[model samples]
Target: MHTAITSQPLPSAAEAALARESSRVLSACLQTRSDAQQIELHDEQGATHPVRVPVSALRLLLDVLTEIGAGNAVSIIPIHAELTTQEAADALNVSRPHLVRLLEQGDIPFHKVGTHRRVRYQDLMAYKQRIDAQRHEALDALAEEAQRLGLGYD
Candidate 1:
């Protein structure tokens, strides 16, 4: 059997880099100064580059990176709590038939608990999170365009 890629962080160098990045992320977040100027990104060479991003985007970035570093990233997560197809579908906000299609396509992992196929609850959550992120991105694009055009948002 092939060795599983443990979700655990890799060795020292990678871990250190992640820590440094996380620190920068935290610093960016802790900047509560009003009249916030444009964000200045410091490069490895100590060169400062100004980049303008909405505060909302920065906050979202902080949240996503923090979650990933905490091993709680919305990506595929192995779960201990097992659930049947119907249960998994409900957890994922999809229909049982849709889950069955995913099973047939070998898109999701599952085990046969005696006769019924079962999936991990964490896996269902991870899948839903992934789908939600994609939907959010598309909606964000439309919203951005609407904002740019001064079009109807409500």
Candidate 2:
């Protein structure tokens, strides 16, 4: 199923604390060598239920919990999903106009449906990775230049 891109609010302090504790417990459980793991869930009425989940799914849950524990908002988008221009912009943390410019410049590819532009999640991620790598390379170069110049940036 394709999930629409949406912004999620950061976890509240109480929720963050609970997530931190839950992540810690789940981390311990994930250290087992089993392919699947059984975990217990406790309801408000003090009823306990056990559920068996694939280790991969458990690892994903742990990642979500870890982000929430750090008070960060998290959104899951399937790799095959198509996003609207605005959604793609939001994913890149850029303005829609800027993203449109990138699309027009051919820095990223997009397809149109009924006059609306749609970007593939995978393409957007590829573009992001490319730009991020370039940025890191530029930064590393600047740092090297600074060290060579004896600018005291040791």
Q: Output the number of the TM-score-best candidate.
A: 2
- Cα deviation at 40, candidate 2, in Å, is 3.2
lDDT (tens digit, per residue) of candidate 1 on 1-154: 1112233443355655585588576656658754333678999999999987766556656665665555452333335667778767766768999999987787777778678787877666677788789999999998999998989775
Residue-wise C-alpha lDDT for candidate 2, range 11-113, written one tens digit per residue: 9999999999999999988997888998789999999999999999999999999999999999988899999999999999999999999999999999988
Where is model 1 more than 4 Å wrong at Cα? 1-79
Measured by TM-score, how close is model 2 to the native structure? 0.90
Output the lDDT of residue 87, model 1: 66
Query: How do all models score by TM-score?
Result: 0.44, 0.90
Candidate 2: what lDDT? 0.93
User: Model 2 shows how many backbone clashes?
Assistant: 0
Q: Give the alpha-carbon lDDT of every model.
A: 0.68, 0.93
